[model samples]
Target: MINAKKLEEIAKQVSESLPPSVKQFAEDMEGKTKQILQSKLSQLDMVSREEFDVQTRVLMRTREKLVDLEQKVAALEASINQQQPESNE
Candidate 1:
């Protein structure tokens, strides 16, 4: 979930940009802005930093295993090719 304090800070910054005439409604504007920001942000697909990092590590490990398996297969194929010629002769 997004941080509430950070959302409030964003809302405050947005409200600060309002003209002097709208200063009387500063509280209302801030509240509404924060609500809208939260609503829209929640609707989007997002992942936290820790979750992304964990997935990255998982991918790295999987890639390493794939490379090892590929090397083993190549070595086995080479050995088979070497034996087939001697038997045919």
Candidate 2:
């Protein structure tokens, strides 16, 4: 059976091997580095590639529809004009 004193001795040895200050400094450095990277990235005006692709597709579709509507309106106007007879009095 493993007694409490042996467990306490093992724990004491583990804690003694590493000083608390060094452990805290390592954690602090990691946090600061993460914050710096995040701040620098946020300053840039950049969209994800997916977002840019979506916008490009939407614009192309809109342009194509507009052109089709314009052609349809022009064709309708032409037909209406042709149906009306010109009278020379």
Candidate 3:
């Protein structure tokens, strides 16, 4: 989700940019702008930096486990092959 404080700051900046004639409506405009910004941002698929980093760490751990499992399987196969008798026997 987008940060509410940042969204409010952006809305305030927009409101402050209006002409004197529209100054009376600045508060209302700020509220509307905040709603619009939040709605639009929610529609998009996004993740916070922290969330992304957590997922990255999970992927790294999973990859490491996969490599370890592969090596173990290879060793087991080699051992099984060694224990089997020759077909000519």
Candidate 4:
């Protein structure tokens, strides 16, 4: 989740950009802007940076294990092939 201070800062900046005539409603604008921003952001499907990093590490480990298993299977196939010719002789 985004930090509340950052959201407040963003809302303040947005409200400050209004014309002079709208200055009277600056506080109200800021609050509404913050509420809208939070609501929209929450509706998005997203993950935090930490969770993304953890999932990336897990994927890397799984790939490494898959590669290792593939090599073992290849070596076993080669051993079986080598013994087959001798059994035929």
Candidate 5:
């Protein structure tokens, strides 16, 4: 989610851009702009930086476990193949 402070700063900038005649409504405009920004931002599909980092770590661990299992399976298959030839002789 976007930070509240950053949203407020954006709203202030927008309100300040209005003509002098609208300056009387600057406060109102600022509040409305902030609400609109928050509403639109919330509608987007997004994740925080921390959440993204945590998911990346989880994926790395899962890949490591997968690789270890593959190596163990290959070793077991090789051992079985060797035993099969000896048993047939």
Candidate 6:
């Protein structure tokens, strides 16, 4: 999908006119441009849908476990308070 050389070839084959100054290298420059552009764009941080989905699933599972642990802690605290021996000096 990230092929500059193929793109430049296609551009030249599609273009009917080329300036004399660059007629000989129209294809080469176009290919080079395509590569540069693709490289730059790739360097930018971009996430795929699949990766995002996987991360989301991981987060959901973590949240569920956290909630369960919190509930257990609260129940234990309540039981401790109820059974605490009162100070009767």
Backbone clashes for every candidate come to 0, 0, 0, 0, 0, 0
lDDT of model 1 at position 50 = 100
- Global lDDT for candidate 4? 0.92
In model 4, how large is the Cα lDDT of residue 53? Answer: 100
**Pairs of colliding residues, candidate 3:** none
How many clashing residue pairs, candidate 5? 0
Q: What is the lDDT of residue 31 in candidate 4?
A: 93
Instruction: Go through the candidates in order and give the C-alpha RMSD of each one to the true structure.
Output: 9.7, 11.4, 9.8, 9.3, 9.4, 9.2
TM-score of each model, paired residue for residue: 0.62, 0.47, 0.55, 0.59, 0.54, 0.53
Candidate 6 lDDT score relative to the true structure: 0.90
Runs of candidate 1 with Cα error greater than 4 angstroms are 1-21, 86-89
Report the lDDT tens digits of candidate 4 across residue range 1-89: 88999999999998778887788576689999999999999999999999999999999999999999999999999999888766554
For model 4, name the residue pairs that clash: none
Q: What TM-score, to 2 decimals, does candidate 5 have?
A: 0.54
Tens-place lDDT digits, model 5, residues 1-89: 88999999999998878898788676689999999999999999999999999999999999999999999999999999888756554
User: What C-alpha lDDT does candidate 5 achieve relative to the native structure?
Assistant: 0.93
Q: What's the CA RMSD of model 3 in angstroms?
A: 9.8
Instruction: Report the error of model 1 at residue 88, Å.
Output: 8.9
Tens-digit lDDT track of model 2 for 1-29? 98999999998898778789977887899
Ranking by TM-score: 1, 4, 3, 5, 6, 2
Query: Who wins the lDDT comparison?
Result: 2
lDDT of 2: 0.95
Looking at model 5, residue 61 earns an lDDT score of 100
Model 5 spans with C-alpha error above 4 angstroms: 1-19, 22-35, 86-89
lDDT of 6 by residue, 11-59 (tens): 8876756666676687789999999999999999989999999999999
What's the CA error at residue 9 for candidate 4, in Å?
21
